[model samples]
Target: MAEISREYMEQVAQMWNARGKGLITHMALEIENVSSEGVRVRMPFNPDFCVDKDQTLLHGGILTALLDSVFGLANFVTIKGISSMATLDLRVDYLRAARSRADVIVNAHCFRKTRHIAFNAGNIWFDGHEDAEIARGTASFALTRGDTSLLEAMTKGKAS
Candidate 1:
């Protein structure tokens, strides 16, 4: 493995967050922090995402998407440049429903990296309660070296 450039790592972080800028743009997810070890993202709450209007519960699928994206990103940052990776498996346990109208934060870490795959785990919590998690998940991704065109294609295809 070659030495990972600090500048390229920052670019990868920006690119990873850009993945969420399309359809999920409404989710208002932002990259809170990034490091070779992990990535953290914040998804601001929107009333339109409420699954239970009366209780103001966020839709479970949104959390799943958040986990999936962060897991892939966690894997991406471990590499040198723009790379392609896909989630092979993702298991999410919703410990509790997220509080609506409050921002949800997710922190995902790439715990293990093999020659062709990366393992990741993450936790989600509403703003101001990072220790009290609402959900946790484990994920694995199939890793490959390539330009970001594949990611662009995937994001565009999903947007359509």
Candidate 2:
């Protein structure tokens, strides 16, 4: 893995948090760890994401969305000079019922990257239960590389 500067990581965190009024913002994700190798994020238990009246069992759609979002973050950290990226393909598997009130933890990494594409994989589980993953996902992203990065485009409102 390449060494990622702390300054760059902080910028990424700030950009992620600054995303206003969207599913990502509604998810209220927190970055726990970040590096060229991967990223770990935590999503606090949200009753709004639950389908059941009890709010203990999490909806599968939420897990899928979480994985997709984290996979994008993983690609952003690992791939350089990307002006924009879009999900080309996504596959998710529900390993088991997500029936916990505990926060959800997701770890994702970009395993492959080329000039125009990146591949990512990740797994999610309730906090403190690493042995039991509730969901796993893999995705491919179409990347557009340019002098201005996605971070710059987002933070500065620069056209890619």
Candidate 3:
């Protein structure tokens, strides 16, 4: 494989929470560090992110999405600095309820990859420590090989 470029990574990382330019953006999810096998993502706490029935705690589904996306991103990072993979199996374990005031940092690593499958692992912590593991996850995905390219994937069959 060729060497991965910083431009490639920054462009791809921006895509992590970009649904489009104006409609939705997770600009709050900042990438602190990146390597070929792993990445670290940080999200600032906001009172608007409550999860319990009373909306006082962090929600499980949001945690799942954050962990899953980071793990899946590790898989894509192994590729040609582009993404053509989606999760097929995602299993998450909630170790403890997290605080809405707790800032989250998700660490995910690309452990292994086969010809068609990628394996990844992730840990979510509110305070970025082993003792703060509010959740942990393991996931698998099937990589899709293609020639159409991401540009087409982004603009095809959509209004200009």
Candidate 4:
């Protein structure tokens, strides 16, 4: 992995938070760690994401969405000159039932990159149980490269 600056990581966090309204904002994700190698994020458990009346079991769809979002952040941190990116393909597996009120922790990284694409893999687990992964995912993204980076475009309010 290439070296990423602390300033750049801070900018990424700010950009993520400043996006204002969207699924990401609704997730209320926190950037626990960021590097050229990958990113780690925490999503607090929300009862609204539960499928049952008891609110113990999280909907699988929410877990999938979390992986997709974190994969994007992984790409953003690892790839350069990316003006935008779109998920070309995504595959997620539920290893175990997500039945806890604990915050979810996800670790994702861009494992490979080309001129126009990136591949990422990640896994998720509850806050304290690293031995038991609840979900795992792999995805590929179509990269749009340009002189203006995604970060710059977003910060300048020019990203769409």
Which one wins on lDDT? 4
lDDT of each: 0.76, 0.88, 0.71, 0.89
List where candidate 2 sits over 4 angstroms from the true fold.
1-3
Which lDDT tens digits does candidate 1 get at residues 1-160? 6766656656766765666566456767788887776788888877777778575788888888889887877776665433567789989999886865778899999898886888899999999997789999998888776555444554565431
lDDT of 2 by residue, 63-148 (tens): 99999899988888667788889999999999999999999999999999998889999999999999999999999999998888
Output the lDDT of residue 74, model 4: 87
In the range 33-146, model 4's lDDT, one tens digit per residue, is 888778999999999999999999999999999999999988887776889899999999999999999999999999999999999999999999999999999999999998
- TM-score-based ranking, best first? 4, 2, 1, 3
lDDT (Cα, tens digit) per residue for candidate 3, span 1-160:
6778766666666664563343124526777777785888887775556755666688787788787778766665556623367788989999987864767889998788776788889988876465768999999888766675443455463322
Show pairs that collide, candidate 4. none
RMSD of 4: 1.6
The TM-scores, one per candidate, come to 0.82, 0.93, 0.78, 0.94
Model 4, residue 23: C-alpha shift (Å): 0.6
